[model samples]
Target chain A: MKRFQQNIRKVVPYVPGDQPDFPDMIKLNTNENPYPPAPEVQEVLAKSNAEQMRLYPDPTAHQLNAAIAEAYGVEEAQVFTGVGSDDVLAMIFQTFFNSDLPILFPDITYAFYPVWCDLFRIPYEVQPLNEKLEIVPEDYYKPNGGIVFPNPNAPTGIALPSAAIEEILQHNPESLVVVDEAYVDFGGETVLPLLKKYENLIMVQTFSKSRAMAGERIGFAIGSVELIKALHDVKYSFNSYTMNRSALDAGTAAVQNAAYLQETTARIVKTREHTKQVLAEMGFRFPDSKSNFLFVTHPDCDAHELFEALREAHIFVRWFDSPRIRNYLRITIGTDAQMESLFAFLRAYLKK
Target chain B: MKRFQQNIRKVVPYVPGDQPDFPDMIKLNTNENPYPPAPEVQEVLAKSNAEQMRLYPDPTAHQLNAAIAEAYGVEEAQVFTGVGSDDVLAMIFQTFFNSDLPILFPDITYAFYPVWCDLFRIPYEVQPLNEKLEIVPEDYYKPNGGIVFPNPNAPTGIALPSAAIEEILQHNPESLVVVDEAYVDFGGETVLPLLKKYENLIMVQTFSKSRAMAGERIGFAIGSVELIKALHDVKYSFNSYTMNRSALDAGTAAVQNAAYLQETTARIVKTREHTKQVLAEMGFRFPDSKSNFLFVTHPDCDAHELFEALREAHIFVRWFDSPRIRNYLRITIGTDAQMESLFAFLRAYLKK
Candidate 1:
């Protein structure tokens, strides 16, 4: 029986945030936007021709690519889109990181990185973040196959300056440096303009975070034309019609409505700052987060205890049991009203 | 510059048929359904809550999986869905075909099989189809890592009996045998019932051909609980949120309207039989086709010449320049009116 089950490709899967279905739960575990997508996106979905779905979608995703390229001030050939940034990042790993040398990433960054490395059989090394949970630029000056990390590093929500990113890019000219900007829209500055200066920089962003289309599964990478072409080559080989028709239409509409994106992201930033001030008064310590989430740790209370207590109160937030970060809890910035409810629960729980 | 891309993972990408924008053109190139999907699918698209797009889609795809399982008379755990059958098949290859022995498939089958083998760095053997382009069951009775081939195999449109498939399955008990049924809905009888008997058998099907949801991109696999679990394991490791929210909604609606699937497929089969008779009278030779498309060759006319002539006349059909099938043209079954137009064009060209 064991012999019959030969050649199973096994890896420990990445566990995403819990999406509970309780109506009363103030869901904030995943960093999804509190507001709805742009009105234009809804309009496009309503008006889209269902008859066109009988035919295959455009495998090249031309219109959406054009919209993204125009929005980012780059040529269409410099953009590559996929189901999500995870898909984009996976393709990048397959296309560029085929050498025997270990790929480099921060130990405390997005958990999906190591899973992709294992999936693609790429050797990788995780450089530990400093005591402050900030990425050390000089730590990555060593020889490596390639490099990748989220811009506003996950869980911690601490972002490195453009100068630090530039220093890493300057030090590693031969290897491709992928800056996953999945959370850059809230307040983190983009390295998109750095494309003109560095050809090896692949900037991956997602409509899931900023454009509020996570359910629609739209992510893209912008880089040199050569790099984009390579990603397309691998994508075309794997699955040409990755982005379905509805996703293409909705994503393009979201990209076009620049005002809605700015308004919603600004609101989230405002709410995040307000939450930070309140948490500071509550004796919670955290880094100044540029992304929409805050990594908080209360010195007097246990994170696991707080996570359970919040769950009991129907206020869900992320808690990782991994080493080093087990003591901390990551809270996604929700609407002002939802944040108030969360604070109300926390204040009462702490008194107990 | 060459040093920058030291390990570029390159494979020959599969060339999908031309999706041209000519208004008057009859598209019989790719195997897309000529009819629109069920009205309920359109209704779902219209009424879907765009506000839900802000949240991440259900990673387990519980609703869509349940819909598919119910339609196929299987447990939800026995089913796995993806972007398309291509995506599902690719995941299957990654999960099950990771051994030292070479996997086996027919040489003249879906071209994507070898492309996937190359992409995954898996060793494979392309067994030659018999002179009639039929899969010989005896040829597969050898030691192998795994097996996969399209039923009513592509570009030939000839289906083997379920008995032959069972013989192959019985012989290769230790290996996982994947039967891709992309074109089964038109006429080919499915071996889905074999799932109860063979634990190592995986049957992959797509909505692209039968349900007319190609642009929406939904495909699924039905297998034993263990095999399906293995696929989910790989999928979760690769991309947890592979399917978008709209795809889930649209695909569920499609499966529920089983009557539409049957009616459209029956209409296609009726037209295919009529077209086969006409082509036979016009000196074209082909095997008895049990799929939605016909693989045909003319005795006196050059297949390439006919292909070009039909293209010039705004009637598109697929022509492969491969070694064995270079003289063959695969024509997808369209509406009766479209097929009439195709016949009219061929009549004038053959006369000329």
Candidate 2:
């Protein structure tokens, strides 16, 4: 006799990436930015006062939205912000995807998508990734209430080119096409420019990845004014003030300091390239990554065994238990020094 | 054509309380605490670091939950926290309120309730308060999946006794009864003690009101472990990290400075009593308030006029547009100096 709704009763919550603590471990899991954000974020946080906290935060997140809108060359009316991309995605699931018609998404993308579908009682179909680990445009031509997938898809880091996504958008003119660009700035191109052509396209991006503000928990969506208005209606009806004052302040600073973000993202991308070369020299074959992480499986051992071996040598990398991805590991690109340590330890462990 | 589900197209977002700027004016709307929080909270804010912002916030808010549980004499498992009481209330709507069975709530309490019900597509019957503007326990005994209303009910500031609440809880054994005690610490008693006897009860509280951490946005729910688990699942699946690091730090500090909260709440309660007397002397009729605000109506003037009159005088209070309560003005009790100015301005406006 559970008092909750039957839909909620059956919901299995999304499991976030494993957060582990090992005193001397090299942590390359969870795909976090290896460097701190622009120093301006820290200064903004430092200047926040307790007196200001007595009043409610700006419900509109005005300044942050303005900066984001300016940076993206979009109107602030086209922007909607939330706690994170996960939060924004949750609202999208409830707002745009709750229908009798099935929603379409990649089977191998962010695992939270299925959990959200179950929670919202939205019928959905998993369009299996193609043999090359790509989202096939033809699969989405069939009727679906909506479409969503990461640009550089998670766990695999393979990017779906904007043209391929635009193809799906054109095919599914009546369905909402949501492109989650969580890892886009790392390598892939943004389809934000195509938004003018496709009024049904809603793009969600995060400061967590490119701007190194993951801990600050700021994510926003851009779309036609009508679509953004629907998102706003849902948000206001729900929490009203989803992001706090500090997050807004830090986020505004992060968006304004585009140079700092570009420098940090470029550095991480360069380090990822170097790490891939080192792995290739050690005869390890991994997917060509367009994001901050690499998906790799070694011929010398089982993926889980390699994960354990690296753990024993004080290196932490992500390993999903789902059957399809169990054979591979997702490794976040670390700093030059951290990657040096990771490479040295991996070489020693693979030699066994 | 738009791609959003039909259900979302009809959701009208709630209008938040006005946050007007009159730098030198007395502000009283929104029930914000008149005094700043303890200096310890400020100390905690000053010490917040960029490093803490790098790692995600503790998803479960373990440390703050421990403090709240200890203060309320409950097990940590009995608690769940969110961005604010509004956020906690939103999750409760999605978690326990959805059913084939129609829900029931007061027509005049917490204007946001209907918005949530509409957004979630939950069928609900609005239960009207008694002639005296009180929530009658008997009104809730009719068929309902769950019950929810504010303690020291909003706008009107009338509270239902615990025994009356117990009667409704006893009648609805198979449903969840949610008591929002957002303003309980101002004067009303908390029903947290009922958690032991009633497994179906969910009590929502917040730091925003009594603890003066409104801008920081921290709130929690206390229920039986099963109910808390349901909320935990909803939170995890939707927004894994609702509270940011600074909130966790400041909330813990606010609770730790118990003496400050006690002293401040006592002062506000005293001011509320004095304000009630002043209203009575001015030939106004109002309900006896148990919260930090007063609900008053005068025979000689319009509530809207009074609201505008106060606004012109650089004072502010809340006015709702509902037909039943349109004649009443909800004024938040503020510091003695502020209230004195308000009274003086009111007397001049009335005579004019």
Identify the candidate with maximal TM-score.
1
Residue-level lDDT tens digits of model 2 in B239-304? 677788888888888888778989999999999899989879887899999998999999998999
The C-alpha stretches of model 2 lying farther than 4 A from their native spots are A1-8, A13-17, A312-314, B2-8, B13-15
| Worst ten in a row by lDDT for model 2 chain B | B1-10
Q: Give the fraction of reference interface contacts each candidate recovers.
A: 0.77, 0.48
Clashing pairs in 1: none
The number of the candidate with the highest lDDT is 1
**Candidate 2 residue lDDT tens string, A1-352:** 6554343444565554456677787778777787887888888888879888888888888888899999999999999998889888888888887667899998899988987887677899999987767778899998888888998988789888888888888888888889999999999989899999988899999988888777788999999988888888767766677788888888998889888878989999999999899988887777789999999877776889888887777788888888677788889998899989988887777777
TM-score of 1: 0.98
Question: Model 2: iRMSD?
Answer: 2.7
Cα-based lDDT for every prediction:
0.90, 0.84
Model 1, A95: alpha-carbon shift in Å? 0.5
Query: Candidate 1, what DockQ?
Result: 0.72
Question: How does chain A of every candidate compare to the true chain A by TM-score?
Answer: 0.98, 0.95
Q: What is the TM-score of each candidate against the true structure?
A: 0.98, 0.95
